[model samples]
Target: MSTAPVFAGPDAAVPRHVAIIMDGNGRWAKRRLLPRAAGHRAGVEAVRRVTRAARALGIEALTLYAFSSENWRRPAEEIGDLMGLLRLFIRSDLAEFQRENVRLRILGDYRRFPTDVVTLIDDALARTAANTGPSLAIALNYGAQAELTRAARRLAERLPPEQIDEAAIEGELETRELPPLDLLIRTSGEHRLSNFLLWQAAYAELLFVDTLWPDFGADELSAAVADFGQRQRRFGGL
Candidate 1:
């Protein structure tokens, strides 16, 4: 709902890529004495809100940490709920994504999911493959350490040690095509990366907010972008 441009000032620089670690869904449900599924449902709404806000704010790419590889340790019922939510989101939002020209991209090896889920995800990806609009990347069953290890292994398999450099390793990673990550945000007062985008965030402006994921909305996202615009980023040169 915010009409303010993300780069409000003359000198404000818009971040090319923004990554978020959406946190506190269980906490939010616990606070309300409701089921965790209720909180995750609310969090999905927040995702929709933030996705629209990011595009309106002129962000080229937005990456959301939807599910981590470690999340498989949770109870089967909770995992089932999450998978159901994923199916619901894709079914409900695929049309909106096409209408808004938003490209959907998955950052992890999502093929290992259930057959139906993988089919749905593949269909979405193929449908949006040609779109030129802002990218919305979801990290499901993702782990930065695992991603890095995979990249390294790929490089070692295809290239000689002399050719295995930073760029080569990066090219093998999932986000190789996205712009350099300029900003990373974590909500729910958390202060850790929790295995999210560790390599891409090497120089990103990290912001930790107290608002829970279910409660985060367009206004909070806009405020974070505005705050990021005010900082000086020298990328280790200043």
Candidate 2:
């Protein structure tokens, strides 16, 4: 994995939107000689911490790559454990999130999920729909390639040949309702996209950190934002 240099610029700005690829849960547990499920359970605490941090930072939106489509390749027991965690998280936190005016959005093909999990997701969305605070989007069972392909198919089905364009496809994306992705941070020192938010992250600043997801806290978050502030984004120009 390649590391990007952090330059201290005179202007430091907090991105409006932040996304994180929370990695290293399994490794963390393996290192401790515990079951991988322990790592996943610990990762849940990090999620709560990061979500609170983002809101405190005045971020407009935060998207977490909670579960990728490829995650299904894991052992059945592990997947069941993750599903249980998801259930517990939504069931326990939905009320607190609503109380804090935090909106909950799921950003993946949830139809493939079990009926009960899908119901919880739907219920969470409905309950928090009126929230006006920072929006938290969890990418569950999401793969950017699949997302793009689905978007393309949807466009082809509805629009004539001449009517299709980048704008049309962008509008059809799951992230269309949220602000543009500004910064994408991957924990556990990984430096790849891993099929998460491919289209939305076209121009996002990438930050790969060595900290495991379970250990990620406000300090790490602050550092990432600080690093983000130091860089210059020229887009396509000098």
lDDT (Cα, tens digit) per residue for candidate 1, span 1-238: 0111232243676788899999999999999999999999999999999999999999999999999999999999999999999999999999999998989999888887899999999999999999999999999999999999998887888888998877787788899888878899999998999999998888778999999999998899999998988887765653
For each candidate, what TM-score against the reference? 0.95, 0.94
Please list all clashing residue pairs in model 1, or write none if there are none.
none
Off by over 4 Å in 1: 1-10
Q: Evaluate residue 96 in candidate 2 and report its C-alpha lDDT on the 0 to 100 scale.
A: 84
Structural RMSD, model 2 = 4.3
Model 2 per-residue lDDT tens digits across residues 21-69:
9999999999999999999999999999999898888888999999999
Q: In model 1, how many backbone clashes occur? A: 0
For model 2, the stretches where C-alpha displacement exceeds 4 angstroms are 1-9
